[model samples]
Target chain A: MSNLVQTITQSRIWRSFFRHGWPDNPLDRSLVMTSNIFFHLHPVKVNRKSLRATYTFGLGVMAVILFLELTLTGMLLMFYYAPTVERAYTNIVALQTQTPYGQLLRNLHRWGAHLMVLVVVLHMARVFYTGAYKPPREFNWVLGVGLLLLTLGASFTGYLLPWDQLSFWAITVGTSVAGYAPVLGSTAKAYLLGGPEVGQEALTRFYALHVMLIPLGIALITSVHIWRVRKDGGLAANDDR
Target chain B: MTNIPTRTPFSKSSGKTYTLVELVHRAPAQMIDHGPENTVFAFPVVALLELLLTLSVSAVLLFMSLTINAPLEEIANPNQTTDPAKAPWYFMGLQEMLEHGHPTLMAVVIPTILVLFTLAIPYIDNDRQGSGRWFTSERGKRIARNTAIYALLVMPAFILLDNSFPPRELLRGVVPDFVAQTLIPGTIMAAIVIAPLLVLRRSKPNAREVVLTLFTLMFVSAIVFTLTGFLFRGPGFELYWPWNMPDGYNPFMNL
Candidate 1:
């Protein structure tokens, strides 16, 4: 068995696939992290204090997981959905009734959106209460706040996609809040709705935002947010005495 | 490990011997005060932990998706509005605030201020003395707990009081619209937020303590308003018990 494993690992194909050998030893373990795309977000070594489950309750990880789930399910949904007013509602009805596991897909995306918002809020609270936002991490906290708003944006824009009475009225109320802003209110509302009210223009604009613009912004910002975590010396828990 | 050379391998080629030496700091710095080095390799451990989290979160989501259906009402009809129409659940706090005063003040101005305050917290409390600790100290925890309880009591009372005898409604004919709608409610809301800071000031609280008091107030008040709007408000957007909402209006369906 050992000889076979060695032969396989020593092969050029295996070496080309993985830049590092088996990660059973220190050098290989470090190489496995540094050379990989996903694991590269992490440092070669992490402070043991930061790994405590109670410290973070893994809310940040959960938020990212939920985002990935949304992306996957959302893409699958896009394959069947048409953003047009004539087809949007029918698409959702067909998804719920006709398509295979379609209701489940919509369910996951919907509940996942709500859960992500809740998790992000709790993560912010955790960071604030832990004093993780102090000093060197102050800007990271700002980034976190920005991410929270984006999360909310993603959820809110997606809320309008079903093109139901619920989505229509909910958005009408939501955007009217933006219209309450003094000078720039109406312009912002018009820009968001793409018209004076919730119609085809609003539906089209929200669909583009829900499926593209907001998610792209979130993806870009989340990369920066995670990178900043490493740049700022891992979690603030490491600084605890 | 000791067999490893302390100098670079190229030293022999350059015909100059080099020795590794530890440089000591002459003055104290931020990095000097840290505790013992307690760390582990991130590769397998963190990777495994993340995988576990991903699976568990996905599993939980799967269970929820399998059990409950996401709400889908009739097709989009701008002509027909849902009674007690609401924003998304997270924005219910702002919607609840709208019931208290003017839209500009409740929805736009106050929300903007809260976001700004949240962003400004770390800068305002820039001290590094208690980073990574929950609530910093026992005193800090007590302050947070008390402030939270105070907000829990005060915010609901303000909501009920404002709802029953809304200054915006009662003083509408007597006072100017701006004074009745914006100025009075704004002052009351500001007082509610600032009163705790004033009490904390008597003790000459540090930056962290002050932040704790303010954040607790804001956080708990947000919960109160969100719960109020999301669960309690019924038809015509009037306040009702979550269990006893009129017209069979189930807020969960709005999610």
Candidate 2:
């Protein structure tokens, strides 16, 4: 009983916890390392040679950062937005005139969305340049390509939510273009808009899709992307090159 | 052990001069080690932290969603068309092309072709088997550069030549319907996508040349497109609209 008490009280973990930050048990470490929910999202011990100050392959990080900015700013903008035609324009005006920091929030959300698209494209380019999209990593690349389309899709759907002349007609013509799909264009266009032309039905449909459907798609594909990164041997080693 | 002395001639390429059923098989650091360590510190906390982060982000978005509403406009009024029935901004590049063409061409077929071409990128560039090493070789790089440049360059030049009305005037001018709009633009779109592969197939450009050509063409397309788009709006063309506007109220009248 006395030895057990001493072991619990005087252990290195206890002492370390008392003095510093973490108790990195390799098991605890392995737990963090191998646990799917957390593990796949992080770099599993990177190659030392790849860690230069100017690692050009770091564009993926920039893309993630841009995505995060979009999410945060987009959420803030949601506070004043209404997905209805009757109130959307007024609500946007109210967001600009009534809400404090509204302009800043709007700018952040708008610009962030634009910038995220640009960054994601650059990220794809960087991955291509460094040969990060090779075997063992191809599926992730495909997921990434899907994610790219989703990003464009989300941006396209959300573009309509603003209900401005630019946003509305843009979405109108956009969905109308969808109506031209050869065999299913009619059904696809109607389904997308929830009715015929871009209107209340279209707005409602885009709203549901932008807020719910597309995001779910992103989350599902992102998991696969992170997993492939791990299985791809932790970034391109660049050793032989 | 019996044949070790007699079989030493062919060992140089094998890294070691001898091996076999009698060779030792333990790692230097673990020759006598028996059990795997039960370390358990790295996994749980990081996962918990990530979980926390994801939830926090989700929570914030939820709060915002609850507080804010997405925008809605006046219900669709068929009589009130906005001129330049603009495309989704991402398609701004394509909408900018429609000013000179027909409905089916600008609105449907061309865009579909462009998207289908985009989706084909993975299939078209399928050369990933690389002995566990580089995914792209010199040939691949050249192909990519050429493909990207062709789109970036040829698109603007075609748009310019079209909008310049040089050919439009000569070819009987501004014909309506899918035949006039869709077919020509679709063919042009297809050619823009196909030109690079045609230019660089089975031919290699060095890394520097590839990168430079790609950027140069990208810059040229963007610059020419913007310059022509903004600097060269015309008075004669009928702009497409989402809603029907009262005739003569063309919003682009000033431009």
Candidate 3:
């Protein structure tokens, strides 16, 4: 018993146990690690044929990583960023100059948003090319399409938060585009902006949308997307073999 | 005996040959693979890789956001509209269409049709043959690739043309209604979409070949459309790129 206790204490087994399985074989350890919920976001296998589909290839996953980055950076930014247009630009300037690595945060958010839009389009194209939109996978594809739009919505809402001349009218143009919905055009613009012309109300509306409504939508649909990918029976199978 | 017994035929005596049934379904090569036959996927290398990738992008973005700032400006100005009054770059394609006509066809009508068509594809084709390869059967792959190529090439020029559309002030003041909606969409659709499709069908080309031709036509159409827009700048000369804004160009000129 003493020997066993001494072995347990001397072996550094606990550290390895957490990171890898006790058996000490690399494959065994990998299996154990992957089975753990904290590490299982990745699948144990991937389909090689569908793997190289050019429409997206690595881009979809890249975008998702960017979104995760956005969430974190956006949170950090929220600590410093003021929504008012008067303070907004100044805050951005402060973030860039005063805060450590603030400019990097801003760039990441900006570029990430743009990249996400591109990635979503590519993801859709990949899905289309691979014919992953067929049958059991159909509902998931539609859900993916929704997620794409939601990502776009997130980008749009985030754009308005800055209140720059470029951001402002870009959003205004976007809202006006929304207003083109026949009878809803005028009223919708009013509703969307929360009044005529983008002002304080528009900022607040966009803030709520960026932080609350759209993120929630993304989370909900993302959950459904993952579940569907699994429920549709792992990765899409190849008909060729 | 003319063949002179070319083979050393010992199979009947030794019973070396298998039955016909043994040669068919029992073949290991043709069997279905169920479950995780791949240990490589279960390997440590890929498991570490995905984690690394996910972590890196997130970390880099975090570093960037903290260092850089997102855009901000003075505030909203209803009295002042920006020059170009541009949509997001993604929507630039539709905007280009708006110049050819009005908002109705490009924004509402066409987008709705495309979305509906996208949604309807699985239902429209009951065949479950093509899942991984381009030509699941033969016809489907052709249509898919052609459509993709067409969308890719035509889309950019369409956006450029949209970049040239007059702002609301210009619209409210000068351009005719007939010119805005009907003439532009109608003409462009005919020249780029309908005419090419008609030509392909008339030639009785293979579906894949036709789609390829269509994409080619699409590419040509974009070049022509963009060039025409460039040549006819009219008063909207301020809306050219650097995509975001141009130097010395006053957007408020329209307002």
Candidates 1 and 3, the one with greater lDDT:
1
lDDT for each of the candidates?
A: 0.90, 0.57, 0.61
* Candidate 2: regions farther than 4 A off: A1-40, A49-57, A237-240, B1-85, B99-117, B128-153, B166-255
lDDT of 2 at B112: 60
TM-score of each prediction: 0.94, 0.65, 0.72
Quick one: ranking by lDDT, best first?
1, 3, 2
Candidate 3 residues lying further than 4 Å off, grouped into runs, are A1-34, A41-56, A237-239, B1-39, B55-76, B134-180, B183-255
Tell me the number of clashing residue pairs for each predicted model. Answer: 0, 33, 28
lDDT, residue B140, model 2: 53
Q: Which lDDT value does model 2 have at A227?
A: 68
- Model 3, A1-241: lDDT tens digits are 9998667746776655555545347575566647677446545554444344352365556766777767877888899988886787778878878998777777877877877777777666666655666666778877887888889789888877766666787787677766666776778788778887788888888888898899888878887787677566544544335
Q: How do the residues B134-236 of candidate 2 rate in per-residue lDDT, one tens digit apiece?
A: 2345655555555555656677667756766633344555554444555666676566644553564345644333433443344345445534443343223
Q: What DockQ does candidate 2 have relative to the true complex?
A: 0.21
In model 2, what is the error at residue B142, expressed in angstroms? 6.6
Instruction: Indicate which candidate wins on TM-score.
Output: 1
The iRMS of model 2 comes to 7.7
